[model samples]
Target: MTSAGSAKKVVVLDYGFGNVRSAERALARAGADVEITRDYDTAMNADGLLVPGVGAFAACMEGLRAARGDWIVGRRLSGGRPVMGICVGMQILFAHGVEHGVASEGLDEWPGTVEPLKADIVPHMGWNTVEAPADSELFRGLDADERYYFVHSYAVHDWSLETANPAMRAPRVTWATHGAPFVAAVENGALWATQFHPEKSGDAGAHLLKNWIGTL
Candidate 1:
């Protein structure tokens, strides 16, 4: 349990991924005592762990595996610990990532595939709105039309998780589309992921981050 008076400790995993400093700053703004570290204990014992990523799917997966990030994320989630993934970080949580005719394995925390967004545009950059479900804690306090920053070509265009565990609520899936529909966010038990970068998403992003910190 945490309070406004007591800062929550969060680790922004540094596994040769995305912008750690920006992520740290965002979490700090959300009242978290954030650290950019790969220390085993620090990562596993933190109140929450944020996995951020940018660039190609296979390349990010390569870096993540080099640091055993998949294992760390899995271990934490299995114990009911909180974990969030952003951008390519979110993509790696699925089954496989197919890019440039190459398929790369992922964490498989959820059942799905990450492929290029089917649009005339490659990277779906800039601020975009999401239709988050009414019951989503990650989107709590966020308006239906609130916009968040996005920067990517690859994403989970098709969602595969429709049912929840016996004791858990149904997975709250959010969607945003470019040329086709894609998974923008997901909330399943202890695992939370966002295809959009809350760090770069202004006030809407801050609210989302705060909502996640509240769960910690």
Candidate 2:
């Protein structure tokens, strides 16, 4: 978080795909001057960066590597600048993609892979709840049981590393499986990611974004 009186600019990566509009709007409301670009210079110059997407892991990674123009991703993350990836955008932050046998290098924010949700329901959509981490600045104004919208068929499942919190009043926020518990959100340095869509999450999501922006 950058603190008050220094609302830094946020560059939302637009690789000709993903949910750019809603994200732009959300960031804008949070007081960040949003710029949707693939240019490395612009990304590097921006105070923070956001990558939002809705698609398969294989294709998303291909687009990122191609439009990497300046490899802005690695540049910013390495430089210690705050960066965030949402949904599929977050999935690409890992080392590889198990979807369709695709293998790619992740930003390595956390050690893991993005695997599909084994839920009877294919694409997990609609308003799902999100539990806030007890001590995360990201969960500052959020309650222990908060509702954040989610839509995905895959997730990061690693109980030891999985950061599980429940959505308010939701009994089944955690999907225990044969293997382990998956992660719903993760944070390392100034970077954070969610398997849900905060931009479309309405009020709770907006506050979460605002809190994140405040940190920058």
Candidate 3:
């Protein structure tokens, strides 16, 4: 066990778009040494970085650039150190977004784009269930009925293609459509993300946050 003062430190990037307070509180409750900072150097030094975002893609991207730029966080995600993104923060991990008729580039940590949810509704609210990806470390303690909080009009349509044969497969990317489809997913490598607010989803959310911290 880690000594009290020797606990792992985590930095939550406050890029001015997401629910900063809720993330900080969640991290703290999960026993991370948390610091809410917009300073690039400070954010880069932590064991883990959590980016929680809300609002438009272009606006959030601008805030991250103005606050910490792209390279710093981008490099860390690429390095495979633990990095978590909630809601639109997760969406921005993809290659881009075509919201409001403007194609805004994402941080490119993941291979996908953020497109508006169509058919059912825009900005899916309340609690919705998510099935765990068959092979995922992020779903360690989460169950099938577990629901997370979501409030967004856009969702990810992954551009990464799946080949019939794992060894001979060249990935082809696809976009998520505006209709009834997958609600949430965890893909790529060590990175994990959600289109919902686990911080607002009671014990289920708490368990996810705790699971994420344990990974750190």
Top candidate, metric lDDT: 1
Ranking by TM-score: 1, 3, 2
**lDDT of model 2 at position 105:** 62
| Better-scoring candidate (lDDT), 1 or 3 | 1
CA lDDT of every candidate: 0.90, 0.73, 0.72
What are the root-mean-square deviations of the candidates from the true structure over C-alphas? 1.5, 6.0, 3.9
Q: Is candidate 2 or candidate 3 better by lDDT?
A: 2
TM-score of model number 1: 0.96
Candidate 2's TM-score reads 0.84
Per-residue lDDT tens digits of candidate 1, residues 1-216? 445578888999999989999999999998899999888888999999999999888898999888888788989998999999999999999989999878989889998889878999878898888988888889988888888999998888888686745765888899998889899999988999999999999988988999998889
Which pairs clash in model 3? 118-178, 123-152, 123-153, 157-176, 159-173, 159-174, 160-173, 161-172
Give candidate 1 misplaced runs (Cα > 4 Å).
1-4, 164-166
Error of 3 at 161 (Å): 5.2
